[model samples]
Target: MTILIPSYEPDQRLIGLIHKLKEVSGDPILIVDDGSGDDYRGIFDTAKNAGCTVLTHRTNQGKGRALKTGFDYVREHGIKDDIVCADSDGQHLPGDILKITEAIRRHRNHIVLGSRQFTGKVPLRSRIGNSATRMVYAMATGKPVQDTQTGLRGYSSEMLDWLCQVQGDRFEYEMNMLLEAPKAGYDLYEVPIETVYLDDNKSSHFRPLADSAKVYFPFLKFCASSGFAAVLDFALLFLLQWMFGSLFLSVIGARLCSSIFNYTVNRKIVFAGRAQTTARTSIPKYFSLAVAIVLLNYGLLHLFHVNVGIPLFGSKLITEISLFLLSFWVQLKLIFKSA
Candidate 1:
């Protein structure tokens, strides 16, 4: 198996990691100098002298781009081995790296993740950031991935082309991999690894606010679109009911208008379904779902407001909130699945 390390403005710890990796496996190790500049040339030279294939970028590109560069090189050189990608900041232990490689060897069809259990003595930022990201990832994809931000991962050689095509340039690229894995017909396997943090992870290049926004952008966009559509649906339903004095007609009219808007925004913006999905297939499925939801929603509204003597506004609020999560899952898993 080949080991790929993406580095930018790294310190001597990188050289140390390279040496440790050499001891374990003599397979070719590729390191991408992500625009470390002239000052860091000596370090790259030392790594090269120690037997590593180094690729250089004129300026700093993100980690994702650097990884793609390494992948492209591996493909061009005709290396058919599975690749183990690890961070250069000394956070990933040599043993854990070997474990990930071994896992990939055994589970050749699966993506192996070197997962860390953030149990003891973790930094505040690391803890909070990982916790928030983990929650969002689970909610968005319905997958319980313990460590969404782990950098040590193993991929089969067959996945090189797909990895190169995954979206994002920086940290968000990693998140996209997990989010898109199911849709791409890949299963994930997590191997437990030791957690190591040095100087509160100061070597990390991740920008918390900016990168976090990118990582969670897909889920956030869905919420925004759904919220707006729900508001419109409620207003239209209330107005139509007040004018026509017929609940069924009001519900149908409001849903017809609101579902059209929701479907368009969700297909084009939220899930990016237009590129991979055709309206011919998704529209019929979406409207079928809309019809089911309309019936269920009206039934619940009638039961809560008319039978249970609750306020109509309260009934609507409760019913919508109850179905919100279900709607998101169905849309993501079934209707707007990646092509």
Candidate 2:
């Protein structure tokens, strides 16, 4: 296995990590400088002298781009070696790196993750950040990953092309990999590793707000489209109810119109790339799901509004929340599935 480390404006810890890596593992190390500039030149030069192949970017690309750069080099050289990526901030231990590498050897078709258990003196930001992303990842993909933010991951030589094609240029790229893994017929296996945050993780360059927005953008985009359609659904439902004075007609009519609008946007835009399901195949599946959701939506609304004494609008909200997960799962796993 080849070790890939993407470093940007790194510190002495990087050299220290390299020394430690040399001690534990004899794998060749590839370092992408990621435009760390002349000031950090000495550190990278030292690393090169210590026997690492270094690639430099003209300017700072994101972490994802740096990793892709390394992968591209590997592919260009026709190296059949599998790769294991680790953080340069010293968060990843060499033993854990080897552990993930070993897991990748055992499961070459799987994305092996060196997941930290997050035990013992965790920084507040690291703790809360990992937890939030973990929950969002689970809700978005229905996959419970122990560490969605971990940089310690292994990929086989065969997975190189696919990894380079995954979306996002920064931290979000990693999340997109996990989100797309299931659809791409890849399994995720986690290897529990030691959690070591140096100096309370102040070395991290992650911009919490900006990077977090990009990381969650996929799920947020889905919600935005659905939320917009929901606004239209709400308006139509109320207007139709006021005119026809019938709950059933209002719900059904409004749902039909909104569903049509949603399907057009989702197939053409939202869930487009993850799957290649043609309109002929997806339309039937989507409508079947839509119809099922509508009936269940109507049933739940009736139960909440008429039987449970909730207001119409309140019931509508409850029904949508209840069905959102089911809709997402079916659409992702079946309707928009990868072939």
Candidate 3:
């Protein structure tokens, strides 16, 4: 397994962390000094002498950008193995890192999370913030997640590429992984890891109010637009029923209206693209494929509600879970080529 560490002006804390890592395994370690000032040069040199590959940023970027830098370096180097990524802040234990690596070896297709037990006298903000974000991630992706903000995470080479592609430039970068994993056909797994908060947990860079907004706003925006689409769908269905006098036709019209609005909004806003032209061209194809999804929605709804006697409202809920995956797959593959 490969080890990646993203650091910012790392001090003796980082030096000690590297020593611990080297003792555990002989994997190639990449230390990304996120534009740490001249003060860290000696530390970097010391780490290099201690057998760790150091990658430097010209200036201090956010933690997410630093992680992207590390991932990009690994991809460019053509390393054909999975890697375990840990923060340089000395919170993660080397033994837990090994456990994460072992689990990754078993489940290469999964995005392994190092779930931290926040049982001790952790900071109030840190505890509440982690709990909130973890629940949001699980809800948004329709997958269960224990800890969304843990830095001791492991990913395969393919997952590395996926992480690099995620567009957040700050703390939201971790949240992006949870949002896009389902779209990219990867699942989440958790390995329980010990939590060690130093300095009474005052050593974190997380901005309580600002970063929390960044992390949760994406999901909130998604929900707000979905609410509007739901209203639009109902309006269209009502109008169509009044004009055409056919219930089935009205429901179909409503489905088309809502699906189109939903897909268009998600493509443009939720999964913003790098290639301008490709994104524009993918909209039509997205709808074309969505037609098949419409059929699926109807079939599942009918099977659960009519055939199996499930309540109509609850059936729609169950069917939407399937729709979420179906639409996500098509969007990643058919719409934006690089999800």
Top candidate by TM-score: 2
Report the lDDT of model 2 for residue 132.
90
* Best-first order by TM-score: 2, 1, 3
Worst 10 residues of 3 by lDDT: 271-280
Candidate 3 per-residue lDDT, tens place, 1-339, comes to 789888876668888988888888888888988888897799999999998988888988888898898888888888887889898889988899999999998898888999987877787777888889877765545566778899898898777777888878778888877777776789888999997888866667787888788898756665666688889999999999999999999999897889888877876776554224364587678778777777898999999999999999999999997686566545544565453
Question: For every candidate structure, what is the RMSD over all alpha carbons to the true structure, in angstroms?
Answer: 3.9, 3.2, 6.9
- Name the TM-score of candidate 3: 0.68
Model 2 scores a TM of 0.87
Between candidates 1 and 2, the one scoring higher on lDDT is: 2
Q: Per-candidate TM vs. native?
A: 0.84, 0.87, 0.68
Clashing pairs in 1: none
Q: 1-339, model 2: which lDDT tens digit per residue?
A: 899999999999999999999999899999999998999999999999999999999899899999999999999999999999998999898889989988998997789999999999999989999999998788767779899999999998899989999988898899899988886778999999999999999989899999998998756767877998999999999999999999999999998898888888877777777668888999999999977997998899999999999999999998888799678777877897767
Q: What C-alpha lDDT, on a 0 to 100 scale, does residue 60 get in candidate 1?
A: 91
Kindly list the per-residue Cα lDDT of model 1 for residues 134-231, writing each as its tens digit.
98787777889889899999999999888888888888999988887777888999999999999889999999898888988987888899889889
Candidate 1: list runs displaced more than 4 Å. 231-255, 273-277, 288-322
**Model 1, TM vs. native:** 0.84
Give stretches of model 3 more than 4 Å off: 222-339
Local distance difference test, candidate 1: 0.89
- Residue-pair clashes per candidate, as listed? 0, 0, 0
